[model samples]
Target: MDFRPLAHFTAQDTWLNDPNGLIVRDGRWHLFFQNNPHGPDWGNMSWGHATSPDLLTWTRHPVAIAHEGPEAIFSGSAVEQDGRVAAVYTSAYADGRQAQSLAWSEDGFTFVKDPANPVLDRGSTGFRDPKVFRYGDSWRMVSVEADERTLLVHASTDLRSWTEVGRFRDEPGTGIWECPDLFPLRLDGEELWVLVLSVQDADGSRVVHRVGSFDGSVFTGGPPRLLDAGQDFYAPATWTGAPAGRRVLLGWMAQPTYAGATPTSPWRGAMTAPRDLSLARVDGSPVVVQKFSPEVTAAFSREVADLPPAALVRCGFDGDASWEFRAGPDVLRLAVEDGSLVVDRRASGLVDFHPQFARVDRLPLPAGTTGFSVLLDRCSVEVLAGPLAVTQLVFPREPFDELRTGGSASARVFAR
Candidate 1:
């Protein structure tokens, strides 16, 4: 198994990163990303574009905005306006400045920088990742405020002038909320849902996710929902019913702790498989499960085998490894030793690790086989463990890992 990055919507490329500006225009889908033209380093941030007609196959286009023009173009949303497609992105120019910049395109590829660049730059701290949407006869934009208390949601009747509407209250636990996005959804048949995410200090152990609902002016709900039960999922963006209709989402996965400071490598980070999203009730309250990409099944079709009756098996990584095991209805656990591995289902739902190179990753499901596969590289890891996939660069303490197998049924591991 060659452990490389995964692309959302489609999977032709192995090293695709963040899913940026996922918008639907003229009955087609446009996806822009935070990309590094040179390779997988974060320093060369640029927007990469892709288009799809059925959300399955994708055609890669040119670098959306070559180098971050005046300010580094971070990420944001796009909407169809006045018969053209418009994009609003967070930019920190080359001269050492940051603000929100907007652009429009007659076609998805060639974007003309709006002459009215920096349309709404209030000399606040710094405005980034502007999520623009159309509601009623007016348009609304929500951005992350310096203070966690206020996730600035602004209103604009026309694309030029803007006014501050209000801020979503910052509650008990919020570190530094980045990338604020909000949209409405219909649940079951009666209720509606609104969701938002604030990327926190990557150096910290986990990321933050919050989902709520709107009643015209503001939004209210319980504490923010944890989008990813795992430690790696972060900086998630949601696109609600493209062209206007179930929301779908894409998330960036990273070892926040490994960013910036690390010497960097052959690859940087990647976006989780695109998920069909919807606000629903789990445990009597509301939670969101990004649906698996339909492409997962296609990959399975071409798979050598399914590890039929996907069992639990102790797996090992010699120098580095690759392969996936279909999960069973039971929970599972995996442990890597000096040169061996162990697989069992009793200790599912929980994850414990050793400080050294030895590592443990437990992808849990309330009722699914603990069976899974592993894709390992000398210094990287891509696990198709439970859900879509989790890819990362791991500086393991040791040079080799031994896999041990346990449990009633055997788990599966495939090697390319």
Candidate 2:
């Protein structure tokens, strides 16, 4: 088997996690991530670079910011300012100290570290992952105090000098928080702020989002909710320089328990397809809805199925329904029962790689959920229904050759 994905993005031949510095500059999409350039195991943290004219196709470049001495580059965000692209990331020291630092690239590929590094240091080892963006007349950054489950807000005029302005604490989960992103979206012409971050504890890794209002100094958000209602999908970061009124996102599509033990060679992780995010009102509450980018939607169709080892399967149903992808004796089942979408992968072939890899996931569908779309790759499945999304990595002994649907459902299979 060939396990290379047809749509999702993966490192050419290494390990990568936590998408870093996602931005669009000069009409091209630039994706940077925490990469281990030397091997498939996660270590030697650095920023790996990739560029795309469109999000669906990518070209891998050299490592953007490699580890030097005791400091390894960690997760952060990128922004375009004054005709140059600036990356604000965490400089993690060998002694467990982490602080925010800066690097600049005139061409958006190669970067030079700031001479006066640790641009925003509180002398706290847990403070990191700076996400910077323009607000009003100045730039604002939202980094996390990981161990405390708090988001630290800072203000900067030059993107170099920073000062703490406020902090927000999220206490819903047992895990520490990391990779915090704050942005605004419109719901029915009313602007609402969205905050997204990752929490990791003994159970595993997960991402959560909250919709709220943000003043220049403080952010008051609603209750935290799972960004993706699945066991996988974590450390999601949104693009910075997208066209006006567009918010696109990408996430690390694997969980911590089995991340290092994935059966794939040459590369250890993959990214979910870029998702176009917007706000929809569900029961009078603003909720985030995710859909594939236009480029991805156009590439998948109702026909053209006999090409690669991957496919996009879409379906529509009401009430109770079921769908299955069968490869000989192995079966991956998805069903809607009692208004919840259940994805069962316990017997999805090749499950012995990791005990945690064989499990079932369920997401409560929004009322009146009429349909869903699933992107099926050789080792993963991403399901989007109503306002909920579930991403999981699956290892099938053989590529699925048959798709079965039950109930009053119409199905469309797309592959290129």
Candidate 3:
């Protein structure tokens, strides 16, 4: 079965994992990712570079950071510092030591690693995935200690020297926390910081977020809640340098269970299209809101009346709605019942590969969620309701070519 995505961002001939260094600079959007250039199985990890005028069509560049003597370049964040773009990443040594390192790019395309690499080491076993941002006059960073399920926060005045401020630990869970990101969102005329964390283990990986307050040093928040209720979402990163003050996000759209088991050749993972994030009140509580980026929506000019197998479809409804997609022996159903959004993909196809791939996922929607969008690729479907987004991967026996909707819903399908 062919699994190439039609509208999503993917490396043409390599494996991609976490989205690294998503930033907009110099009138272009820069996307760096965890990539293995030699093959599709995820080794020789390096930072793959790409840029786009808009977020839709991407132009791939050469590998930004190659493997050093005993270390592979891991995930990190990028920022513009003093007329150049700087990338702060983790160097995972062959002997199992991980440390934060730095690289610089005069232009967005070419990058040079700092000679004084591995700038910071906490002397811990699971420290990696550093996300750096500007806070006041200093730069603040958050990296995960996977073994301890904690996030270590650090502050640096020049991005070279650092000091540990505090650590954010979560309740005991089955997985190890990996990517940790902290950013503020304005809601109800108040600013609230959102802590984004990704937990991964043998089972798979899932993203959870906490909404709270963060001073210059410490972050205190409420309990963590599910960010995306799907089996294929992980390692999400947000960028604030977009047009307006939009907090745009992108996530890896593959699960760890079948990371290297997909039928696709040369490439193994792809990223979810960019989503504009906000905070909305649902039942008197603020929830994370995700919608398609305006630039992404504007990229699709030709709109048809019905879904055409693989298309970017915008959907809206007044009351209740239901939709079904089918291709040969595969069928997936989506509906709204009693103010709850349901996705039943039990018979969606290719469930025999993993035990946890076939299941029904549900999300409670607000009272008046009148519109949403579904981005249907060749083998994946990403549905974005108001404050909930569901991403699932399915392998139909044949390509799904039919779509049906009920109630007052209408589908506007767009293809590139």
| Each candidate's clash count | 34, 0, 0
TM-score of each model, in listed order: 0.72, 0.97, 0.94
Q: What does the lDDT read for residue 325 in candidate 1? A: 22
Q: Which stretches of candidate 3 lie over 4 Å from their true place?
A: 201-203, 316-321, 406-410
Q: Which stretches of candidate 1 lie over 4 Å from their true place?
A: 6-17, 53-56, 68-70, 94-97, 147-149, 172-174, 202-207, 240-244, 260-266, 302-405, 408-416
| lDDT, residue 189, candidate 3 | 91
Writing each residue's lDDT as its tens digit, candidate 2 over 148-169 gives 8989899999998898899998
- Model 2 TM-score is 0.97
1-416: candidate 1 lDDT, tens digit per residue:
22232333322332335567778766667788777767645655677888877564578788887665456667777877777778888776765555777788888778887888888776655567788888779888888764444677778887767787777765555456677777766667855655566456524544444556665457676776556644446677776345436567767765455443322245555555555656556556655545444443333333332332212222333322323221222233344333223333222211233221123444333223243344433333334433323444433233213333433334343322
- lDDT for model 3: 0.85
Off by over 4 Å in 2: 302-308
RMSD per prediction, one decimal?
7.7, 1.4, 2.0
TM-score of model 1 (CA atoms) = 0.72
User: By lDDT, is 2 or 3 better?
Assistant: 2
